[model samples]
Target: MPTEAAFSWPREFVWGVSTSSYQIEGAVAEDGRAPSIWDTRCRMAGKIANGDSGDVACDHYHRYPQDVALMRELGIGAYRFSVAWPRVLPRGRGQVNEKGLDFYDRLIDAVLAAGIEPWLCLYHWDLPQALDDLGGWTNRDCAGWYADYAALIARRFGDRVQRWATFNEFSVFTLFGYAIDWSAPGVTDRDAHLRAIHHVNLAHGLGVGVLRDLLPQASIGAIHNRQVVWPEQDCDADRAAAALLDEHWNRAFPDPQLLGHYPPQIAAAIEPYVRGGDMATICRRLDWFGLNHYGPIFAKADPQCTWNFAWGEAPADAPRSALGWPTWPAAFRDELIDLSRRYRLPIYVTENGAGGSDSVGADGAVDDPARVAYLRDYTGALREALQAGADVRGYFVWSLLDNFEWGSGYGPRFGLVHVDYTTQQRTPKTSFGWYRAFIRDARG
Candidate 1:
């Protein structure tokens, strides 16, 4: 490992950007695409901010060529994107949608033609409504359904798309969707949350097995968002609260995947709710682990808080993003280093970016220096972690363009390129130029 003073990425380091289908693809009902849970949820009253939806998000489904051109111009080596399940299996199981498969056929070809590798994520919370109506992630059978879908995608596009992520942020989807009722197919029952979590874990393992069987040479993995839970005070009570927070947020899903066992604390907490063999199903081995990190959580012992711990209100003097997340780069480095040591898997910064309110200036350019600073500082943190012996192989910025941000809608922009929703125009922000320059320097 390089020491702190001599830290730098390998010459072939992968520089990439990531985006999801439901967040960017749009054309929800076109080309034989069917409704996803997200589509159904956004139509519900008051479910999303400004009553906004991703019905026509950036028209990436129609304009991917231009997007690929942008990636090529930015000197990026890879593009991490998700495929919509409903797009491929319109009703989520029985029949395959040729049109849906064709769309991705073009997409993968476009990325390769641009000399960029396509990293495909099989699921990104856009489950087909047909599946959710029957049972969704809460149903064990959904695991088999997901595996079938994964098999189809791998057989169809595996030759071109060498990197595959089985699921994107399973904890977020399970907790927010079931426990908090803030995301799609919203349910607010703890039992449902526990069930969903189990099914998602099983799906990951089953999906990986399918991908490996079908695309034997492909690199298969999952993207899980891991956060550092720090106590507000060093007291025993505070430390205990922090431990619980960590079990729920960071270790719950990964522990099972990497170690084949749930955290003892989490298992005890949910013991009354768990059924037999659920833990074993979640302990699937993975080829790689994608770490989607943003900021740290400072928790305090609080019985009143939903999860038995509370995140103190945004600090009075700290800088925050449009999403109100603290701007802290140190957390990024620490989290990566810790995860690298604990998991012992090749790591990828699958997602990291701040949400900001950006607009095209009168000069026809977006001067997002704040975003530039965020990227620079965060990249420096990544370098620091590498110096400390983290086996990080790549960094994929959170987004390439501003698209739907789930419950928050499009209100918060987390893109290097600004998207004018009404006009569907893409304008590269100053941060985009900075990233391009960084990639050039890293390559040099």
Candidate 2:
């Protein structure tokens, strides 16, 4: 364990919190916002936990000013949020929603007024249901549609927001949505999976080009969720599963986008979708690498699934968070160091935190000691990575408020502030104070 005195950061290091459009902003139908794939998925029976949907999630759509005030008081230097594709483009392409664009314009102005920089992420897995109707990322035309949407956002908010992320966690969405039935637009077909993989990479590269062209002064990057993968057992089958899972989960996105070639396991499989000059289009220059890591994952052979590998469990004795995710700060440390060496760009830990089942206590206080411990341990490892020469420039916690957590719905709380779903109240947890003080001391 590192002492508080040992954990120090440079003055230029950025500290922020991240939240997505679908996860936080409710008001799905208001302001001409059409249905997203997630909206459709939530309507399906037994898709989301407790049958909960994002219909009224935290009500951030109407209460963003209050959220910005909360962030100002927390003393963060930046706020990273996403724009809902369906909200901006309604049916995904032809028509523009001025009301939807106006909402973000207001939100961005409020954030800037509070003296906090805003990092705009274009996509966070909320594909317009209209696009999914046309086969979503499984079709190559989807990339061009995404680029047009990017141009609209750039022309509207480019002057105010200089920090841009093309997409967040590409592997997690493509893998879960296409290969497994765990996410929205769930389809378990190999061709669909391969097409999605190639088209998304193409979209990212196109989005990056658009941002660079429109916002010449902007800093651009794409967020990837990378974690070490381990086999559940010592057998050959488990090892093979772990290896393949690692390639898909870790190497699929960054390997192609940064290195200009797909991973060995996916190279031949995705070749059918590749055309002349496609590799060049998929490997645009990025200013930084955004990493959203929780911890290492364990893989086991599963003959029943489309990918043939299933999520395995950690040993019963390993340290874990309230959500049963393994708590290994060393893995976080190693990931930062390895990412720095591999990509050769400034790195930002865009999202790193734990999830817990927190409830407001009787005294009107949220005392989450586990969350504080998790942040402390992870940040300690982060400092170690810095000392070992990882070119890390920023660190943003997973979220600012506990909103919708995908298929798990609102069960896992990964927020520094606790949000009451009924009243839409925001209460800063004990970890919030810890982070505020930590940032103050480090930056001072």
Candidate 3:
């Protein structure tokens, strides 16, 4: 059991919930919104489970006012949401979509009107199809294109949105989207994977520069899904394997953005696949580092792992999410300390939640005790890290509503509010009440 001491965080520690545009904002084809890579990918045969699409996801585009009301009632201090790139720049670049901008304008005002701060994430894996057609992240020119888009959005909305995130989970985009071929613009080529990672890192740094130039007072960072990596055994081979995995998965982006360099081992590993001058563009400074940590990974030496990557294993007895990810809050605290020591930048828990098989009880309540416990454990872990001297600043639960779950579609629920997709009804889960109380206590 976790302790509930008289622990208190700094008054300014942000407590909020997070959502992405594509995940919640339906109206995919409206307001000059062209197809994103996600849109195109979901329509492909056998791509998304249940053939689900975000065409009418959660209908947040239409019901944002209600959602803002929910946030106010929940007593959250801030909300972190992403801007859909395709919505603002229909063809990726060349023209502005006023209607699309108007949607966000109203949404931002609604959030502020409800007395809730709005944190904006510029990109959340919803790359415009036009950009993907032009080679996407694999193309070196994409870094410049993304920077221009960032400048445009920052210049337009930065006044109202004081906190900005350049990208959501950069490593996930490169790993699942390019290397593993599990996400949009999917391609399973190792060289493409390395190129995509470097280009995405460069795009983030360049985007930061643009945001800094445009919004001088705005706090900016990139959200990375970091994990504490450990060897499954004490053997030298397993330790070496774990080190290699850490160099790529853990140190790759943080070193570049925070320390102004990539880990030398990672640089050497991907050197032959790197294009000219990519590293220089990637190594830019950031004001803060956004970390989305859930659990640790137990890595073992696997000679057959791609790029000599270490194989990760979750103990059979460990609790698992609906997505089969292991639940390990202890690992979460360790990751926070490790990142604080390595980067020395204020960190935000940008996204952390567990998905489970949730159901609406006969009493008209969604009983999600598992999710409630998960949040409790993770929050305790976060507090532990703070007590241990991590420069932590905020926490944003993974989602506010259950919408499209990528390849899994709506099969997995990771929201405080349960959505009946068929009727478009929204109902807060038991975990929602617990979170509201948790926030109240934290604030107190």
Candidate 4:
């Protein structure tokens, strides 16, 4: 028998699945839409797995109504999706593309018609290629640029959209895309990373102000992947290394956004970029706090490094996802408890799901028992934290369908519903049925 999650929630809690535009909506050339950084990066040789460019991945751009129907059938209360920057302001600034905006207008309408609340995320790392030409996130001008874009969308969709988020996973976009060569705008500059950090936070602060002013009745927040920080082993160096990384990856954004300043450890490293009043702008009052946690990343000290730390792998004996992420539910619970107590805001598990080797079985249905188990364990742990007084308000699965998985491409599946890339067929796996039952049972 499957281990059912003994969890309950308030009647008004937000429950849904999360998806980003670049990952699922695959009409790269349609609607006068300008190319995003991911679109440009995908075409480069050896960038994505199987040379996939999301050119035709899942074709959700054309098939969103069917996808919305899936959400409705799953009995979820909300749907969180991102608006592609290039799709709205194709050039990322000047003229707004009416046709591109029309697509989202239709998507939000469909979601509303299905009786599902639309939780809109302003940016999800799909910066316009044109904006990349203008120094992208590293450019201080991006703060105003993003604020303008936020105002445009909040004005357009605020009527139907009940919840809003500034950006999804700030650390990932800055560190992976800027500091490392794995993601789009692929570069390896420490100074650029430091600069981009403050700029992105500035954009968030400005974006939050736009949402608050335009959508005063709606709840506003930002999604961050600030999970449990741990050391590689019981060693002084590793513990020290973990502290620095925790300061950078975990506290760097939220502290300034919530507490009005950076953690002392990395403050000097990024002080050059911190102009006057930037911290005040970053620490906007949020109605809720969005946390995306999978598991813990243990850090190890390294002498020859400027950052002085390296990402050490999780314990080998632990349950592992197909993407090799540690499936540690205790860490998930710890994070939920920590955030609820520290942030003092209604916590939402914005993105939490395991990446699995999902496939369409010979019988034509997808079988992903591991993902079902992963979700069960993690949510059970979330329930335990809630029972122990964590003010966790809701949980949204990482994705609704398997589309682009970023640098790892489409190889890792993180969706309850499996997507056959070739046929654009959507098959709800075992986890889908499990989630549906769980929601139905919890609500009842």
Question: Which candidate number maximizes lDDT?
Answer: 2
Q: Which stretches of candidate 2 lie over 4 Å from their true place?
A: 1-7
Q: Model 4, 97-144: lDDT tens per residue?
A: 998889999999999999998999998999999999999988999899
Tens-place lDDT digits, model 1, residues 1-444: 666566556987889999999999999989899999999999999999999998998899999998899899888999999999999999999999999999999999999999999999999999999999998988889999998998899889988888999889988888788876789888877678777877788888888788878878888788999877778777887788889878877877898888877788767666665567766666666778899988877778887645666565435676766667877788889888888889889998899998888999999999887788888889999998888878899999989999999999998999999999999999999999999999998887
Task: Give me the runs in candidate 4 sitting further than 4 Å from their true place.
Answer: 1-7, 303-306
Error (Å) of candidate 3 at residue 219 is 0.6
Write one digit per residue (lDDT tens) for candidate 3, span 176-219: 78766679987877778888878888898789888877888888
What is the lDDT of every predicted structure here? 0.87, 0.94, 0.86, 0.88
Alpha-carbon TM-score of each model against the true structure: 0.95, 0.98, 0.94, 0.96
Ordered list by lDDT, greatest first? 2, 4, 1, 3
Residue 33 local lDDT, model 4: 86
TM-score of 4: 0.96
Clashes found in each candidate (C-alpha, N, C closer than 3 A): 0, 0, 0, 1
- Candidate 2 lDDT over 1-444, as tens digits, reads 456576667879999999999999999999899999999999999999999999999899999999999999999999999999999899999989999999999999999999999999999999999999999999999999999999999999998999999999999999999999999899989899999999999999999999988888899999999999999888999999999999899999999999999999889888888999999999999999999999889999999988899999898888999888998999999999999999999999999999999999999989889989999999988999998889999999988999899999999999999999999989999889999998898887
Off by over 4 Å in 1: 1-5, 232-241, 269-281, 300-306
Q: Residue 25 in model 4: shift from native, Å?
A: 0.5
Q: Candidate 3: which stretches are off by over 4 Å?
A: 1-4, 231-241, 272-280, 298-305, 308-311
Overall local distance difference test of candidate 1: 0.87
Q: Candidate order by TM-score, highest to lowest?
A: 2, 4, 1, 3
